[model samples]
Target: MPQSPTAHDPNDIQEFNLDAVAGILQDEKLDYRIDEHDGEKVIRTGFINAAISFILLDGSLTMEAMWRGAPSTDAAAQVLAATNEWNLTQFAPTIRFFELNEGTLAINALRHVVVSAGMSHNQVGSYVMSSIESAVQCFEWLEQQFPDLVTWKDEHHDH
Candidate 1:
């Protein structure tokens, strides 16, 4: 005797919408606010007020965390070196050094995933959680390099 085919689960066929994204975040009790940028809705939230921006595109989502007032002067060189090393070694959360101000440099850790076709609620949750976790991990690793990267704002106060 042969076995019969089973139907696909509806729970797995989830639509990628801001509301669904918020629902997932709400379920985790994480505070998130929706903001519109260029007519696209984005999710803004954080870990310990570190600040992370979530960009939801047609079939993709991205997470960006910036370390303001990061390495400067002598430290800038070291951070550039470390950033090159991290980018060359790590696989997740691509890191980059940017000059946001006149001289100070900021570090950005970014992660992205494509989900335009659609996904299950659980899949969406995993994608969102993974993005946040990886971003935080990247920030933590950089902090280990400079130790004071976490206090960039507290010490500067002018940013």
Candidate 2:
């Protein structure tokens, strides 16, 4: 006599491991944490960029940038909207943000945006390579012309 597909003996020891499979799935979704520090709150650095701690002070809102090559302006705008909404819904009230393309003009705009946002020069990248270095050099010149604001986190050595 052979056992039926839906039939199982109640006393049989089931030998499949379920927990190990779930653990592997969770690990794959985890983001890389680069740095963290505590002050009035906690600041963290992750795979893409740095994150400032959320504070209750007036004009104290958290923001971040995701800089990489994108297909088109429409795609970039879509990503920005999706990211902004996700951040607002999952965490803080609002976040100031933008997406920079891999082109020369977009790179220049990003430099200006970062300086205006009061982020450190080290945090920004030109993303120029090969023959594009000359164009990137021009953008750097433009960035030098614009003065950067001294942000609070750097002043207190919290970064």
What are the lDDT scores of the predictions, listed in order? Answer: 0.76, 0.28
TM-scores of all candidate predictions against the true structure: 0.79, 0.22
Best by TM-score: 1
lDDT by residue (15-103, candidate 2, tens digit) is 32222222322344533232333333322222221221211122222223222222244445544554455445533222333434343
**Model 2 lDDT at residue 34:** 27
Top lDDT prediction, candidate number: 1
Evaluate residue 1 in candidate 1 and report its C-alpha lDDT on the 0 to 100 scale. 90
